[model samples]
Target: MRNDPLLSIKGLRVEFPTQDGPLVAVNNVDLDVARGEVLGIVGESGSGKTVLGLSAMGLIDRPGRLTAGQVVFDGQDVTKYSESGWRNIRGNRIAMIFQDPTTSLNPVQQIGAQMIEALQSHRDISRDNARQIIRNAMVRVGINSPDERLNAYPHQFSGGMRQRVVIAIALLNEPDLIIADEPTTALDVTIQAQILRDMRRLSRDTRTSLVWVTHDLGVVAQIAQRVAVMYAGRIVENGPTEKILKSPCHPYTEGLIASMPANALPGERLHSIPGGLPQLSKLPAGCSFAPRCNYAASACNMSPKLIQISSDHAVRCVSPLDGGS
Candidate 1:
């Protein structure tokens, strides 16, 4: 990872107004993505990983608001940008590949036309030039017969192929940062692996920073250089991927790793975390994971600040398993 981060998020908090109360989807969070680096944000559904990614892109729609924090990209705080300002940065300097290609692509539009529109929206390019750029992007994402595929509608392609098209569109601008929210979850394992490999190669070759948000740690292990584990809207652990996987410090992190199929003994049932995630609006005080944690104690009743356990590893737990004091 580069020393100078290309994207930085500090004290980010996203919330939705509710009749009962404000539902905090993303608690105070800090994150960074360096140029040419792939950072994975991993957690179960409703863990705020997706909300966090959307907040970074300035896409948290009304009803949902960025209550606090700064999303700084390339030295500019984007949280303060106007709609027009966001237009200049979003899709040009930063792009996002959302899950479900069916939703991302226009069913009525030809693949080539959609890609061309995306390219032209950000760059003043002619039809022929835009087509060429789109074609190249398609090829980069492992789409075959770029010319032929361009003329095809989204529904004409399979699930994996449609996702490839979405990825191609996101890469057409060659943005500095790409936030992918579980883009491959809909594909079969084989196709998912292929796309992951292609994405990693593309990021490395283009020097684009990538933030991959997903529930699958397996996906993260394959593509990310670093990992941030989220739970109940806050990051519980952050560190190098190898270290996080091999020696998770937070209880939630440990539970996630222990529950992975690879960690199970042959013929043994996969482990699972004991409790479902708490409601955002009704989250308990202190460590949110404490209620489900085996090591919970009196100190866990008070919120624990994220403390550095190692030079590069941090965990938000009063009694981090890594032995930090």
Candidate 2:
């Protein structure tokens, strides 16, 4: 059906073997992303957002493994895909744009060479045809003189420009889904805005599903249609962007929203959630966030299941703010 989600992750549990024991990075996480939709996963560092994205792309490497879950893409289960199987689906059906283009791209290779290799790896197109596609993609991403730029090495470009090239490579394959893990975080405010705008336009034009992972709420406001707040290896809250931003239910979500720079008045002291993220390996017996929660009640001593507050809004908290249902 046309209504089916483009990607679905159910009961995803990714773990790593540590001396302490199995360190769970993502625990029973569930998410759905429809075609042409922009879903943002926001959380502090080590909250498992990056791990979850890698798992979705079948890129989880040694020491880290998906213990249980189903990753269905376009009606096919890719959770159990072999290495070769992933090779076909990775760049062809789903692509990834990492946080740092400087490291993701090779310094010795020319930009054109890398782009051509990426294209030819997944598609059977000739080098000449791939060159044309890469040129057009660079132009679409707002790079001037794409032909000349393509011939240059990654070091020749500026930080923002290199990121643009990375974006271009992700779009070159016209993949159905793109997982961008904080692609704009390394850039300045102006460059961040420009890159986000280009990506938004391109994804909409191509009807590609996007999963944007970041810790910046401002970035999510600019690009995401829906937002998921992750904490200590689990999603504590998720809902439409507008509702989640304006009426956060969970204490963690409330803290995140309150801490945004835009919410503060002139010269007013900024609000911040007390305490740091708890260690995942030694998480509390109840909710992981209960230690820092301002409104923790007696019921919070026990973990609460994700409860639906509305048709599309859910929060994993025993005592949600504003008397949420």
Candidate 3:
């Protein structure tokens, strides 16, 4: 971890009021993203990855409250920020690229106009200057003939091009941090690769921190410097991407890696973890993953806390696969 992280999340908890009860979408989670670092958050659907990202952006809406914890960005605790305060920080200091580009873009507005509006919204710039910036940003994302393309509406662009426009808009203000919530999941493999490469390059060039949320470990391996494996609203393991991929400590992390298609042998069946995620309101007494863990023991019945296994690696397990006890 860096001495001064760009974003720090401590004991964060997000809950939603449901008919049954208050469902804890994000359990007590702590994370840090250093400047120019790419931290990948990996988990199954409903594992609270998206909620965690939204919490970082201060975007949790009505009924879904940030019940606990502090989200510190650049040493300032933003949980205390009001809506107006968040407005200044949102597009100006931090930006988010969501999963769907269509929903993020305005169908009726020209792409150039939208991009120019995004830039001018955060910065006091002239229309001509903003348009130039938009054109440069579009070209940076590999959008050809940016000047001509700018006049086209979102519907006129292909799925990949729309996503590129979204990325361009997110980077227009040059925010310090970017939270991408599976932004490439909807694209084809080729498009996904291009986007990932561009994002990684952009982060490195700008020294901007990134938190990428996705269910695909392959994506994490390609782009993330560090990996956090989340399960049942908690981080089961976190460490350098190479270490997490090569020597996963948590059973859930191991299972996730094993289930990857790249790890499967030709003609052999793909591996899968048994059982599904537990209901947050009705989680087991101890570890949430104990029910599905093949190595689960009686000790697992007692909830475990995240413990350091090395200088950087951490895992929440009674018996970590790394031989920790």
Candidate 4:
């Protein structure tokens, strides 16, 4: 049986005010996270992956706002929620684990104190109960000697351990949705694998939906069952993980796949996508990717909306690749 998605984000446009004009950081996009699944948002830096994730959680900072579209969670349209309403939803029903755990965590406070506060912020629970929950969560995330660790400040833990603690904090409420932006970026490869595995197992055990935002295709590929490839504030392609990675249609998606070392031959010089990312303020009139696409044509000058390439795959390019080099 098909499971209804717990979150549906449609036409999500994010804009920031500039001296010249408004800048679209996250163009019109659509995304969904079922009751139990990890949706991967993959792209290079400045590709709108993190921006879109932030928009979903209604945490856009100053000068930036969710200008257009809807952020619907659990069958309700959250976009209309007042600031206080949104605040109530944040960190209780939906939480985010930002890229830099060090910065996301409070520096001066001990881990236990911050974690207890996070729990109490959402639930009307006692400090001792919150501490017990924190300990259980710490052990759940593989932290040893929960009591000793809880007393330690955020700076005391290694990068990996800190990240895990951040993950535990996010999971404290057993939220239906968790947005993890580059959670594994600071860790070594082995540690990255272990953390990703832990996230996968925990998601299954807890029935929480996850949106993993990262530039590492390898990490997303490892944990996400569905993939969304974004570039220049738009989603260029999205589909099942196997189909999108093995048979990417959009030129940008193809370029990202081609750049992966796994696809390169031994002793071969690495291939990078041609051309630099266009300035967001000076975005082109035609296809945003036309500057780098090798197969550009006059028809490509027209803006293209995401069109289905297969039963479950979609591409935004007028002329997508035909599964070949």
Please give the CA lDDT of all the candidate structures. Answer: 0.91, 0.91, 0.92, 0.88
Residue 316 shift from truth in candidate 3, angstroms: 0.5
Candidate 1: RMSD to truth: 1.7
Estimate the Cα RMSD of every predicted model relative to the unseen true structure: 1.7, 1.4, 1.7, 1.5
TM-scores for every predicted model? 0.97, 0.97, 0.97, 0.96
Best by lDDT: 3
Q: Per-residue lDDT of 100-211 in model 3, one digit per residue for the tens?
A: 9999999999988888888877789999999888888888888989988989999999899999999999889989999999999999999999999999899888888899
Poorly placed runs, candidate 2 (over 4 Å): 323-325
- Better by TM-score, candidate 4 or 2: 2
Please report, as a residue range, the 10-residue window in candidate 3 with the lowest summed lDDT: 316-325
Q: Candidate 4 — worst ten consecutive residues by lDDT sum? A: 316-325
lDDT of 3 at 205: 83
After TM-score superposition, what is the CA distance of residue 216 in candidate 1 from its true location, in Å?
0.5
Model 1 lDDT, full chain set? 0.91
Where is the poorest 10-residue window by lDDT in model 1? 316-325
Question: Which lDDT value does model 3 have at 126?
Answer: 97
**Candidate 1 at residue 174, lDDT?**
86
